[model samples]
Target: MNLSTQQKLEQALQRLAPIHLQVIDDSHLHAGHAGNTGGGHFSVFIVSDAFAGLSLIKRHRLVYDAAAELLPSAIHALSIQAKTPDELK
Candidate 1:
């Protein structure tokens, strides 16, 4: 079975136990752009306790690590907004 990029991202990010998660596909917005052969562009908004006390870079690192296998292939680029639940309140 084949999984869509959004599905793949959701599955991979599950380890974070996010209180809220949203994956937006922005491929259409970049259509015809150079370097966009087949891979998709995405934006992720995730709220999880896992981000507590972590710096922005560290939070982004966690997100990148989870989605490492998809980089430059299934996913060409990613924009992430990772925040702790407390930070949202």
Candidate 2:
């Protein structure tokens, strides 16, 4: 069986070896939007040491790269919150 978008996100982002990761699927909330189609809407909260010294833009870029195959395809939207363990305190 094919994996869901949420599952794919989790698997892809695992490359960063997050200390904590949460993925929320919000596709149902965009039922009628043109971009909705079969693609999914999601938000991710991830804490990882990999993000330790990166700037906000770079951090987002890292995440984007991680999910590169899903963008504008299986995933219509993604809201990400990337942080380090210390930042979570």
Candidate 3:
């Protein structure tokens, strides 16, 4: 089977060094949603020490950095729940 949305998200996080992560593709729920024309919406649950000492906004910036061009184009909406491993534990 092809990699699921969660798997794809996991891969993204892993590529960025993740301590914890959960990616959920909620595309099915947004059939006619904007940007959902091709790809879909995603909820990213990520926790990593890489986020330590950074503000939430900065953490999101990092995610966007990692996602780069994929954001909004391939991923319509990304509900990012990012945290540091210390916060997760």
Candidate 4:
């Protein structure tokens, strides 16, 4: 994976004002799958105020909006587990 992804992730977190953010590249797990040739798929654990009062769907949408440009290109799959810090505990 390139630093650009991390930078992009950070930017997204900044936009969301996340209390906690974890980004794990799962591309190796999908090495043979389509869109896996590029460095993209990831599992994200995010705790952010942007998700605090939102429904699960909304939370996902927010994250999706943050990385909208990466979809189907720089990022193919994102296994997102969005939560608030309190919700996580």
Best by TM-score: 1
The whole-model C-alpha lDDT of candidate 4 against the native structure comes to 0.80
Go through the candidates in order and give each one's C-alpha lDDT.
0.93, 0.91, 0.77, 0.80
Cα error, candidate 1, residue 35 (Å): 2.6
**Candidate 2 or 4, higher TM-score?**
2
lDDT of 4 by residue, 3-85 (tens): 67757865766788888888987777888775364757789889886777789999999988998877767787888899988
Model 1 steric clash pairs = none
Clashing pairs in 3: none
The superposed Cα distance between candidate 4 and the true structure at residue 35, in angstroms, equals 6.1
Cα displacement (angstroms), candidate 1, residue 21, comes to: 0.4
Give a tens-digit lDDT track for model 1, residues 1-89.
99999999999999999999999999999988987868899999999999999999999999999998888689988999999999888
Off by over 4 Å in 2: 35-37
Q: What's the distance in Å from true for residue 35, model 3?
A: 5.9
Distance from true position, residue 4, model 1, in Å?
0.5
| Candidate with best lDDT | 1
> lDDT score, residue 51, model 1?
95
Off by over 4 Å in 1: none
TM-score of each: 0.94, 0.91, 0.80, 0.83
When 2 and 3 are scored with lDDT, the better candidate is 2
Worst 10 residues of 1 by lDDT: 30-39
